[model samples]
Target chain A: MARQKMGGFNAGSMADIAFLLLIFFLVTTTMDTDSGISRKLPPMPEKDQEKSNDKIKERNVFVVLINKNNQLLVEGEPMDVRLLKDKAKEFIDNPANNPKLPEKKITDIDGKYFGHTYFVSKGVISLQNDRGTSYGTYIQVQNELAAAYNELRNGLAMRTFGEKYKELSESKQKLIKKVFPQRISEAEPKNVGGGK
Target chain B: MSKFRTKKDKGTPPISTASLPDIVFMLLFFFMVSTTMRQQDLKIRVHVPAASEIQKLEKKSLVSYIYVGSPLQQYQKIFGTEPRIQLNDAFATTNDIRDYITSEREARDEKEVPYMTTSLKVDEYTKMGVVTDIKQALRKCNALKINYSTRMLSSE
Candidate 1:
């Protein structure tokens, strides 16, 4: 055999192919964003508003409890969800109705009872899954609460303009939304077990 | 002695690579046109649990909700004490979840500034994969600043 010429194999094209693949995947893979109910958090209460002297004294606080069966208990009363929305709307639309308000404002209102400084706490849902409550039932209760919040917000929106909610002017509608935040924020972590 | 030359170059052969760039361009166009553009996928279905003691959130006009979950199945499965659709079962449909989220973002972004934030309330039992799906979808839609709702009382 004639003296063999030892030339290394050219890998330039292989590098080019690899580079092309890198670009391909980079272009093909798409990133996703958080997909959940769009909720705006209430701004921090003013420093003065947070004065400890005010003490968030829990009074007439609406205690709505959701159980593993998705049943709703408003202040220990088993109320229909539709009725709950109307009741909640009445309280939120006019805080004056919150019974927890100072006795003066509570009495000032035409009725003896009125809504108070309502602080719909994040954990207020209080989902108590019984020993055998399936995860599915728990989810249903969650959905219903979400719907109620939406309904309450929508109803308040309607009340603001005394018209169908969808027909309200954009600004007026927005004003209502700012007040409700769709009333759906992030769900608090489950308290897990307890009936108190 | 005169060195033997291979066949004297016939009239300079026309360079064929002048069109090489055009071929590359055509190939690029073909790939772009034929390749299915991968849509950003959400990792999970996030169904926010609702609260009875729900505070009315203000400035809701500036917020948007994205439902990330198994796609809406036409049929409902009555499995347990309460009626709840199964989440992310292999057969559950999820095609619209992404599109719905994308459209909501597009619609809201058009009317409001980009300052709007998204709050995610995923069911505790939802799989991590489903949550990823939701996040990927949100990123594609250009939504940011996800908030998780939690109870101060529970940990206490």
Candidate 2:
């Protein structure tokens, strides 16, 4: 019996194995990174933190509530998310300057002047959610709210600084941010109208 | 003269197959390098909700993740089916969140601390109870930069 020595290992199936691994990775790999709603969390309330709710008038407070049903209630009335941005913008800009809106025009040393510039600190958006609210609906509401602020800032930046909000210099961007500081205040999740 | 005008068939010339492995190897390396392994073997099943508007969280190195979802199948018997929070590699209650945020901040350069952000990857259907608690804890730690992880969808 002649024992024939085969040279090393088999390479016949190597390509098949590589292709299998490549396909596995190709299907599972996620190059499109996770994106999100970037928000600044409010600091933990201090023991002596002053409660200033009395200072903000009813018209100055744009209260948005999301019951467990994922339904939106802007300023105590049930509203659809579709109408949220405009309602929020109207409230923030107070285009009508109807003292009824949470918006107010004030002079700031930043130098940019406008006919209907709302005082950033005067307008407040208080958002409350239910314990049973779906994250998707909650996020959509947040996106609409944030989009309202972004558009306002961007429009103001375009008009005041001759550049988009994102394209402005750091100092100029800071000024815009200071003027329309994001003030989405979250309230405790209430067990409003959803399942126990 | 005819040889110049007419092509001679050497019984169908064989195409070179030598570089096949090299080409495939190049692709393999590219994927291997670019592919980020599933970090923090998720104890909770997090399917981030979809949204129309999204912002990219800048400074990848300054970002940390907090996942919230119902317990996985095996752990359901012990941890129950209720949604739970997972910080880094393990499941944790809200009590541990402050520490987690502090440790994550501690890992960063001092100057970069202000730029650090926490990405909350909460499942779409998960209750917001746990999420609110985590946020409160994060706020106490002054890790106020929060990014609610969401998937981007078109057509509203």
Candidate 3:
């Protein structure tokens, strides 16, 4: 057998292949993932309500809690996951319990509320979760909260105008949605307090 | 010369036909074993409030965020780089939030028409009142979507 002379090691070829593989993986991967629950947040307030101190103080508020163990607490007491929707509805409707009708209002040329502005006010939804809970559990809670709000909002629209929420007149629905509190504030667990 | 000077090997040393395949295989195997798969990464940890009926949002940007923590009440700040305007200050008397949103909208670029997608990242121990106050502020933005950020559960 003839002895064969070995050539120089081809470092460049190995380098090229490695680089190509690295690029392939980088491009193929998906960069973003769902943080958890997806929700359609309510719009910001309109002009009329902008100056009413009275309306701000007396508005309805809903409270939700998730303990370190991932257990739920509505208001102050522990609650079953099943009660989430009903509880949300109950809280949302608390505002409408008031007897007074929405006040009358006059607007400027830009449709901005000039005088006293009236809106069907939906109260705020307050959420608080413990530090130790998992993200999945948190998302679960959020979904429930939104569902409760939607149910309450749609129910009000149907009862008040005798029409489905989507089919109702835009102006009328807008009025209804504004008063309906779609805002959610995540409270600190320390202040969640004792159950009602 | 002793038996014809041992036949000298000619041409290029037997081209490493197997070397390329072996190198490629080793490279592929390394990546397959060593590459870490990306997963959901949440900036803040959360234990979401549970509900029976769950629905996904149509648009991701529209969802609002509210973060809650014990000491967070005193902090009164937004996470990351976004500015912190206290919830109480924003929603204090009347609808001050409405004013903030309007100003924000005006300052936003006209071309993008960025309909301010909003959320509040609250601390876990935040007071319900403060949350309410913040929510009150968000109501002023009139954003179409609202979502709280949370981490994913491990399969274990």
Candidate 4:
């Protein structure tokens, strides 16, 4: 019997298979990266612990209240949301050493992070919002407050190490965070009218 | 000039497409490496708020998403226009958050439980009352590490 010579398989359909895979991946995968503002909530208090009202100085507390209408009442004065960052920075840094501003405590820094001691602010930003406030406004306020802290840390990092805060080593970043700890305390939400 | 003139009878040669499949396969591999498969279909219409101070969440496997928004057009008739919370594939109430957290923790490695993060993707126009309730539920369950999922604000 005489056998026919074998020919190469056609390769034209290879492109079609690749196209099918590409389309499948394009439809199944999401290109958007997830990002957000990270926060750690305070742990639940024990039932047995006494509810002691530890007194905090009025000057050290920066009260930021958002009413039901989404209007800001910062330290009892009506202000715009756009200006909240500068106000927060001023309160945290107290650069002018104003008598009414938060007091600074002289903290001893370990030689590992810094050779000399630094002055750490004792400011605590107390944020209270009404239940009727819009979620957008709430996040805006939180973002502005976080931006204030980041800017202060960046400035200090630049002056001290000539590098950005994010670029610093983890321990060194912790040292800088010690200088300006993000002390935003959120109070429980309250019903302030204008709600169903 | 005559040397450069082409013969009229000999038409232009057809370009070879031997590399076309290779190029397409390269694109397919790139998409497979860089992007992640969508985990679930969204029942709520969520338009996350924007912010400048935001951080990219690391370790996608460790994150548990909590979506808060009004129901889509099809579900609006049954669910009403009010904002609702969605966990995994179904609508959930604030009280369901604790159970959700427990199940999420149980599904992962014990060592990774501490590093687990709960991401709240809330719509911008929704009221804060629902968000606060969710927060309280999370706190009760001892899931303290939370992220308010927001997009990058272009203004900078």
* TM-scores of all candidate predictions against the true structure: 0.35, 0.80, 0.39, 0.93
Write one digit per residue (lDDT tens) for candidate 1, span B1-156.
233344344456655444444555555566665554453333344345433333333354554443334333343232222222222233222344456546555676565646666555445544333444444455555565554432222221
Backbone clashes counted, model 4: 0
- Where model 1 places Cα greater than 4 Å from the true spot, the runs are A1-36, A41-53, A57-60, A67-72, A77-83, A93-163, A175-191, A194-196, B1-156
Interface RMSD of 1: 11.6
Write one digit per residue (lDDT tens) for candidate 1, span A122-187: 212233334323333344444455555666656665655567555778866655454454433332
Worst 10 residues of 3 chain B by lDDT: B82-91
**Cα lDDT, model 4, residue A58:** 93
Predicted complex 1: CAPRI docking category: incorrect
Q: Candidate 2 vs candidate 3: which has greater TM-score?
A: 2
Query: Chain A TM-score for each candidate, in the given order?
Result: 0.40, 0.76, 0.52, 0.92
Worst 10 residues of 3 chain A by lDDT: A101-110
Cα error, candidate 2, residue A149 (Å): 1.2
Using lDDT as the yardstick, the better of models 3 and 4 is: 4
lDDT of 4 by residue, A94-141 (tens): 999998999998888666555657778899999999888989999999
Which one is best on DockQ?
Answer: 4
By lDDT, is 1 or 4 better?
4
TM-score of the first chain in candidate 1 relative to the native first chain: 0.40
* CA lDDT scores, all candidates in order: 0.45, 0.81, 0.52, 0.93
In terms of TM-score, how similar is model 2 to the real structure?
Answer: 0.80
Residue B60 error, candidate 2, Å: 1.9
Q: What does DockQ give for each predicted structure?
A: 0.06, 0.45, 0.17, 0.73
**Tens-digit lDDT track for model 2 on B13-80?**
56665556667777888998787656667777889988766888786788998999999999999999
